[model samples]
Target: MFLSFLYQYRQYLVLGVYVLISVAFMIAKSDRVNVNLKSAAISLISPLQKVVNNVSEASENFWNSIEELKKVKKELVRSREELEKLKGANIEIEELKKENERLKFTLENQKKIEFQTAYAEIIAKDPSNYYSSFIINKGKSQGIKINMPVIAYQGNQKGLVGKIIEVSAGSSKVLPVTGVGSFVGAMMADLRYTGIIKGMGKTSDHVVLEYINKDATINFGDLVVTSGQGGIFPKGIKIGIVLGFQKVKYGLFYKDIKVKPIIDFSQLEDVYVIFKQSEETFYQEGD
Candidate 1:
């Protein structure tokens, strides 16, 4: 009967026995036993604490990496913007440099010229009459007048361009040396052989030095200069270089010498109009 009772209450009996043992242990606890208990508890919890710390550190590291990546990306974008700005600045600098160079070249040419001249720009040029006629950006307002000699600077020497034929308030028309109606009294620079220079238009690409004595020694490369005879152009200004002489098919007392003008009409941009001619050059109104 007792055994049956024990079986029926076995669970409760085991629980009671455990409570009694815990009470006994508490009441009879010693320092060494408590220390051993603490050690065992720490040993069991150490791995779990380490796992938690490792997880926390890993999470912190991931956030730090993300922040570093964002900083790098932002810096890259800023750097790209700065590079583009620098490129624009460089282009502006180059343009300024080119402009400065052009100004310097013009200044150099102006310094070498001796004529009391007015500097003018070629504002209008007709392609059909490119070498024959052009317009300047200065006129009566700038003291420009009809028959004022226009000249260009090239290779450190002044060359005859043409004469102004028409003038307005702020603009003037120039008849170039290559114009059919243009004529200038020219002479050989070294030999003093005098002749007349006559234009044959742009198609000829040259001028004819007429009435040069056939017996005169004509050098192929002799420089032709204004003789200042017709009172139009100043003396010593370069007109052209002698290229060759044309053989007259008929009997003639003069040699037809072909001369290439010193100035390259195709490349003409700026010019100096002799508003106040030298003491030797007297401006005549017509022809």
Candidate 2:
């Protein structure tokens, strides 16, 4: 009997259920208690939401810091490259300054000299040999010839350095005044007494002036200059200074004298070779 009664009320039952759902929804929306329950549920989940947001922001900041570090590293590398370039430029500037100094000195001396000359750089030296003889960078290719007079400007003055004994394609060998076979006709600047300046067999700081007569006054600091007798060297070229005089057993007339070459071979860097002398020089020969 109840089943038969439910069959008859099925349509009403469905309509009543729909009405109940609509009424419950409207009541929840209007009531303050239901609104408070919704607020409480949001409060319970807020801490989790805050933690997730903090993690996201931290990740973003970490990536930004890495990018900043990369930019700084690039800047540092560029700075190092610039510093290296500056260092190279500084070295080039210093080299240019030295070259200017050398050319200036050469030009100043060239004005006072009366003969044609060739500027040559001393390239190689035998330091073990007092540098009495060395090689220059200029040679026959540069109009250099054998027996050409080599002069150097040093100590703020021009002085005779050597003679070109050998010439090659691109270089020349200089027989400096202090060599074993070196010989020059020189005279006392004060007394004008001429003598033969002969080099010792072993390279030495001083050469032997054998033709100085015992009568000629010789002093420890007397300047000696070329006499221009042989026509090989120009007159007024500084030969050396007289250190002392000694009596020898062989020649009683001409005593032995020690003279030092004014050209410091060890410090020789640049030289001028006499390509041609403007005038012929002659010195009176003494017995």
Q: Tell me how far the alpha carbon of residue 94 in candidate 1 is from the true structure, in angstroms, after superposition.
A: 16
Best by lDDT: 1
State every prediction's TM-score relative to the real structure. 0.60, 0.59
Q: Note the Cα lDDT for every prediction shown.
A: 0.80, 0.75
Task: Give the Cα error of residue 184 in candidate 2, in Å.
Answer: 0.9
- 1-287: candidate 1 lDDT, tens digit per residue: 99999999999999999999888778866645653454355344444544665687699899988998999799779867876978647656776999998898878887877778999877666558435687777766688777888999876668999998766556677888878789998999998989899988978878899888888898888999999888878888999999998776663677889999999988998899987765534543321
Count: clashes, candidate 2: 0
Residue-by-residue lDDT tens digits, candidate 2, 1-287: 99888889999988999999878867787576554453354344434544654687699889988998999899779867875978647655776999999888868888977788898876655456444577777766688777788898886788888787766556667888878778888888888988888877434667877788778867798999988878888888988888877568888578888887787776787899888884433211110
In candidate 2, the residue pairs with backbone N, CA or C atoms under 3 Å apart (3 or more residues apart, or in different chains) clash, namely none
Residue 62 miss distance in model 1 (angstroms): 54
Highest-scoring model, TM-score:
1
Q: List the residue pairs that clash in candidate 1.
A: none
Flag regions of model 1 displaced more than 4 Å: 1-105, 127-131, 249-251, 279-287
lDDT of 1 at 189: 94
